[model samples]
Target: MEDLVLNWDLGTGGLLLLAVAAVAVLLVLIMAFKVHAFLALMVTSIGTALAAGIPPNRLVEALGFGFNPTLGNVMLLVALGAMLGRMIEASGGAHVLSERMIQLFGERRAGLALSVASLLMGFPIFFDAGLVVMMPIIYAVARRVGGSFLSIALPSAVAFSAMHIFSPPHPGPVAASATVGADVGLVLVTGLVFALIIWGTVAPVASRLIGARIDVPVPDILGDEDEKTGFESRPKVSTIILLLLLPLVLILLNTALNTVASTTSDPDAFKATPWVAILRALGETPIALLITVFASMFVLGWGAGKSGTLVEKIADSALGPICSVVLVTGAGGMFGGVLRATGIGDAVAESLNGIGLPVIVAAFLISQIVRLAQGSATVALTTAASLMAGVVAAGDYNQMQVVALVMAMSAGSVGFSHVNDSGFWLVSRFFGMSMKQTLGSWTLIQGAMAIVGFVLSLILWAVASAL
Candidate 1:
C-alpha cells in the first residue's frame, strides 16, 4: 500500500503532540480500562489516522500498508517456531534435556545447569511456553538439591526471558527487527551473543544473591510426583540438542553466504549462482524453521512412538494458542503504518535530530517508557520500533548499526516487569512468592538484564560504527 496523500498537514510540533497523545491513549486503554492490546492498538491507530487528517477514502489502505507487510514476514516464523516448540515439549524432550544438564553440572550447581538448559530450549520456545514446560524440572531440581527456589528457578526463568527478548523467531525481536529494517539473521547472531553475555554475568549472580537474601521454597504448584515417570520414552538428549540447533545453524549459514557474496565484485551475480541460491533459500529464516519443524515431528514424534495423527494434532494444537499473539502483532504493524502514513515518524525523526538525541539512545528510552506503561515486552518493542522506523530510514546506519539499535530497543522492552505484567504474576504464583518478594527478586533481575543488555548494545553500536 502506498503512503496516504494528506489534504492537511500537521506541522512538526503538532505531529509530535499527536504521536504522544496517541501513545498515551493507547497506554490508558490497555492499562486503565484493561482493554485487550489488539483492540486498543486498532482503536488508537484508526483515531490517530483520522486525527492526522488522513483522507477518509485511503484510511483502510493506510492501515493495511503496515499491517500486511509486517505480518507477511513475521507470522510464518512465529507459527513454525511454536510448532517446533510444542513438538519438543510434548515429546518430553525438554525434561530429558534438563535431566542431562543436571547430570553434567551435578547437584552442587543445579541452578546453573537449569539455566543453561533453559537457554537452549528457549531458542525456539516463547518465554511462557518454555517456563511452563520447564517448571516441573525446576521444581524437581529444587527439591533434590535442597536450596532456595529462587536460586534454582530464577536463573532458569531469566534465561528464557533473555533469549525471548533478544533473539529472533520470538515475536518481540522479530517484529522490531522487521520494523527497523534490520536483518533477522544478524539480529539472531547478535542477540544470542549479547543474551549469553548478559545472562552469564547477571543471572547467576543476581539469582544467587537474591535467593540467598530471601529464601522462597519451591511451591507444590507443579507436583513432584512421577516427574520422571515418562522420561524413558522421550527422545535422546543429543537428538533434542540437534533439533534445537538445526535452525540456528541453517540461518547462520545463510548469513555467512550473504556476507561472502557481499564482498564479491558483483554481489548480485554471486548470489545468483545456482548452488548459492538454493543454499540461501534453505537458509532463509522461515524455510529453516519449516524444515526444522518437520524434522522435529519425525524425530520427536514418530521416532518417539507417537502416531501420525497424534503428531498432526500436536502441530494443530500449537496454532490455536498463538493466534492471539499473531493478531496482536499484526495490529501493532497497523498502528505503525498509521504513524508512517501520517508523517508522525518523519516529524519525530526531525525533532530527535534537533534535540541532539542519539537515535540508539532514543530508541531504548522510548521502548522503556512503553514497556513500563503497558507491561508487555512485545507491545513495547513493536510500538517503539514503529515509532523509530522513519528515523532509522533517514539515518546512514549500516546493517550492524541497525541491528544494534534493535537490540537496544529490545533491552528496554524487557526491563521492569511488575504487577501489570502477566509474566510477573506467572513467576510469583509458580514460585509462591509474595507480591513483595517478587518485586524484590524477579523485577530486580529483569531490570539488571535490561541494563546489561543495553550497555552491550551500546558497545556493539560503537563497534559497528568503528568498522
Candidate 2:
C-alpha cells in the first residue's frame, strides 16, 4: 500500500496531545492492567495510528512501516548474538573470560574493567549489537562477583550508549555532522573526549546507586547456570578472547574501509573495488556475528569434543529464549514507527525550530523532543541537525562551534529512553528487569547522560566562542 496522505491535519498542539495520550495508554495497559508488553504495544500502535488519521484500509501497511524494518534489523543481531553468547556460555568461555578479567582487574574493580572494555568495544560497535554481545560476559562477572547485576552491567550499557550517541562511525553523529556541516574528524575527537567524561563520571555512580536499590539479578536468557559444566574442558582465556574479538575486528575493518572510501575523491569507485566490497561485506554486523558464531562452533564446539548435534542444540536453545525479546523489541519499534508515521515528530520539530533559542540549545531541545516523540535517536539527531542547517550556515560559526552543535544534538537524541525505544525493551528483557525497574533506573541513567553531555557541550560552546 502507498503511504497514506494525511487529509485531516491535527494542529501541532493536537498532535502533541495525541502522542502523549498514546504513551500514557501504553504505560497504563502494561503497568496497571498487567497486559503483556507485546499486546500493549500493538494495541497502542493501532489506536494511535487511527487517532492520527491513518486510513482504516491502510492500517496494516502503516503498521508494517515500522514493524517490518525493525524486526529485519533487530532479529538477526539478537538471534546471532544470542547464538554466539550461548556457545560461549555453554563452552564455559564466558566463565574463563570473567575469571581472567577479575584476576587482571581484581574483584574490587571488576565493574571498572567491564566499563573500560565496553567503552573500547563501543567505539566500533552499535549499541544494541555491542550490548547483546557483551551480556554473557556481564552476566558472568556479576554472578562471580556476587552483587547487583546493574552495578556491573549498567556502566557497560551506558558506555555503549555514550559512544553510539556521541562518536563517529555510528550513523547518528556521523549523519548529524554531515547534515550540519561539522568537520567529521573534529566531531570524532570532541565526541570521544566528552563521551569518556560522561561515561566515566556518570555511569559508575548511577550504576552503584541504582544497582544498590533495584537489585536486578543476572538473567538466564542465554542458558541456565546449573546446566553449564565441564569447566576443565572450557576454552582457554586466550581462545575465548579471540572468539570475542573476531566480530569487533571484522566490524572495525569494515568501518575503516568505508571511512577511507568516503574520503577518496571518487567514493563510488573506491567502494566498487572488489576487495573493498568483499571486506565490507565481511564486516557488516550480521555477517561479522555469523562468522564469529561459526568460528565458535569449531574452536569452542568440535575442538572441545562436543558433537555437531550438541552444537546444533546449543544454537537452537539460544533462539527459544529470545523470541519474546525479539518480538517485544520489534513491537516497541512498531509503536515508535506508528508515532513517526503520524508526522508528530515533524510537527513538534517545526514548532521548536521557531522558538528562537540559541543554536546549541535549540539543537538539543529539538532533538530531545523529536526523539521523545518518535523513539529513534538517529531520526531525532538527523532531524534536529537538518532543522539547524540553515541557521548554522548563516551563522558562520567556527569549526569547534559547529562541532559543539552536533554534540549537543547527539546528547539530546540519547535522553528519555522509554518504552517506545527498542533499546529500552532490549535492556529490560536482557537484564530481567521489570518495566518499572527499567524506567526507574535505565531511563534515569540515560537522562543523566544526556543532561551531563549537554552541559559539557555548552562548556565547549563557550570555549569555542571565546577562542
What count of clashes does model 1 give?
0
Measured with C-alpha atoms, the lDDT of residue 210 in candidate 2 is 94
TM-score of each: 0.64, 0.98
lDDT of 2 by residue, 1-467 (tens): 23568758998898899999999999899999999999999999999999989989889988888889889999999999999999889888888899999999998799889989999999989999999999899999999999788888999999999999999999999999999899999999999998999998898788779989998668999986558544225678999889889999999999999889878999999999999999999999999999999998888888878788888888898999999999999999999999999888888998999989988899999999999998999989999999999999889799999999999999999998998899899999998998999999988998999999999999999999999
The per-residue C-alpha lDDT of model 1 at residue 12 equals: 74
For each of the candidates, the C-alpha root-mean-square deviation to the true structure, in angstroms, is: 7.3, 1.4
Give me the overall lDDT of model 1. Answer: 0.76
Tell me, by TM-score, which candidate is best. Answer: 2
Name the TM-score of candidate 1: 0.64
Residue 195 accuracy (lDDT) in model 2: 92
Which stretch of 10 consecutive residues in model 1 shows the poorest summed lDDT? 223-232
- Please give the TM-score that candidate 2 achieves against the real structure: 0.98
Whole-model Cα lDDT per candidate? 0.76, 0.91
Q: Top model by lDDT, which number?
A: 2
lDDT of 1 at 443: 87
**lDDT score, candidate 2:** 0.91
